[model samples]
Target: MRDMHESSADFSDSCIKEEVLKEKLLRPARDIRSILRWGYPKFSTIRFVADHFQLSLEERHILARVIMPPDRIISRINKKIDCSEIKDRKILIDGYNVLLTVDSLLKKELMWFCDDGYIRDTRYYFSKAKQAEDIEEALDAVLGFLSEASPKSVFFLFDAQISRSGELAGFTRRKLKEYKISGEAKTSKIADFELKTEGGNPESNVIVATSDGIIIDSVKEVLDIPACLMEKMGIEPIRLY
Candidate 1:
């Protein structure tokens, strides 16, 4: 086995080298961004981007997060509200989207700072039991911040299709209560569709909380709550190829 001091030096060297690689990814990310802006499907673009970069699927996955389509999408993403602006506004959280992003932060999963500067993550597919701890951590992180923001109200929407979603909704309500945050939890057959409608309505005074690109585009305002927390904690995205 390596000595402790030797191991520490090795870790430091590897860590710096990894950071360099992540920085280097920006080149390919720009290329991929250009490909996407030309109306290419991301599915096809992803494979082509991966092949062009000569990277593994995981590397491509992380890179895809950073590479996004041009202007229209970027403009929509820019409409998101700053974390500091969340105070006193009613927030409708894209529950899984926000929750999973923070969970990924904790797991050191791939995070992409999109062209418009908002951060996003992709890793919501998993069994509930396997995600219990992450779910709890994610909820606590965002709700705790909202508690500080003192939002007028919050609405947490989960996907009905996911197993134990109802149970998770209940847990979320209790957590809101514990945090002294005002919120209701509901499971939806299509949370995205519901959130799109609700958050888009000017009369609702509801700001969305999600990193989902589609929902972000549809809503008038968004709060990348998970992104805020991750940044606050100096939690960097995972680097693995």
Candidate 2:
């Protein structure tokens, strides 16, 4: 799967001085979708086609992530549940997945608005989330919403392999308590299996809150927490709505 994206060019990251021009590059990326529907090719190939336009390295990555998602992935995204759908349901959160994304957005970091209409943080999350200063606030923001969404319960699952995941699980549970939401967190060696198996039960009123594409594909419904939070804050992301 890692072979799906490749470093195409050593395009300079100097677009900070030309933000307006950079936005126009999205036009070419939009057209790139025509060929992408055929399959997920190396970003190098797309870069070869886009070379004439002089796009920055970051711009190219954004375009690739947004446009190059496989057709099956797009089909799954259509089943993503909305905030309204979770009003009376329970939510199973891929803990780090949600926290890392919210923290990145809160810190004004670069995020990708992909073809599936979901905002994604391109950073290697497991390494970077530990370095973020607002990790607790990110957790609180997510929990606060579940409190209001009136879900029957919420389950937060963190990967045990990650550093301080047990600590994160404890913190998440406490936040749930403070918010008066019925929920708890757990550290799992196989969180993917745990979520996929438990959330797949048709009799359960469980909806998952995560941006992990693989996990999302395994479940019946997913809720986009950051998108909901941003909507409440009146920040409309480009093409994500």
Candidate 3:
């Protein structure tokens, strides 16, 4: 029994030493000139380099600054998180704000008449197809990200004019619950109006996620709650992912 315990301890120490040596050997040769070069086009090269090397979280954070020098690293980190203390906060998302950002990424197909006398209606058809694709893709991304991040609760508000279906409602509910996130949907003529009326006290804890400047300003004025926007098309909240 004593011999077995000693051998196990030695093995553990050896494994630790091997890991430490591997990390030291893998550490990149840092250069100020190379770091400055990474700043071109705002960290595009640096991000690629970080990803290529499979950098650890701490290393990635440090390299992120090398690529794009920011006055405050803490603020940059905070922006990536839904909140520093997000476990207790309910997140209200403006559905249209998320959809529109996604839609903007899709390229619009143009209809042009041939040299001969022919008419083309390609734009109309393309628009319809793109809209459907955009909605599905955007919803998947948003729901998947939120589900994994597991905010305390997420309420998605959509305009009644869009006419969402029961299937989508059921899908979102199941997905959220599966990931231990509470999900709810509300359809109102004006989501902002509903939010303002429902938001109880000035100190009632909540975070509204929207890109609308007007809505954000109003919410802050009324409830004194902080607001954040979903990331731009093809860009997700960094640390959360």
TM-score of each: 0.83, 0.80, 0.43
lDDT of 3 at 163: 45
lDDT for each residue of candidate 3 in 48-87, tens digit (9 for 90 to 100): 5566676665555433323223333233333223323455
lDDT of 2 by residue, 79-122 (tens): 68877668768889988888988887666555666667677865
TM-score of 1: 0.83
Give the Cα RMSD of candidate 2. Answer: 7.9
The local distance difference test score of model 1 is 0.75
Give Cα distance to truth, residue 159, candidate 2, Å: 1.0
lDDT value, residue 148 of candidate 3: 51
Q: State residue 3's C-alpha deviation in candidate 2, in Å.
A: 39
Q: Please write out the lDDT profile of model 1 over residues 5-87, one tens digit for every residue.
A: 55677767856765876776766776676788788877678778678878766667666665556655657766778778877
| Model 2: lDDT of residue 2 | 12
Better of 1 and 3 by lDDT: 1
Which lDDT value does model 1 have at 50?
72
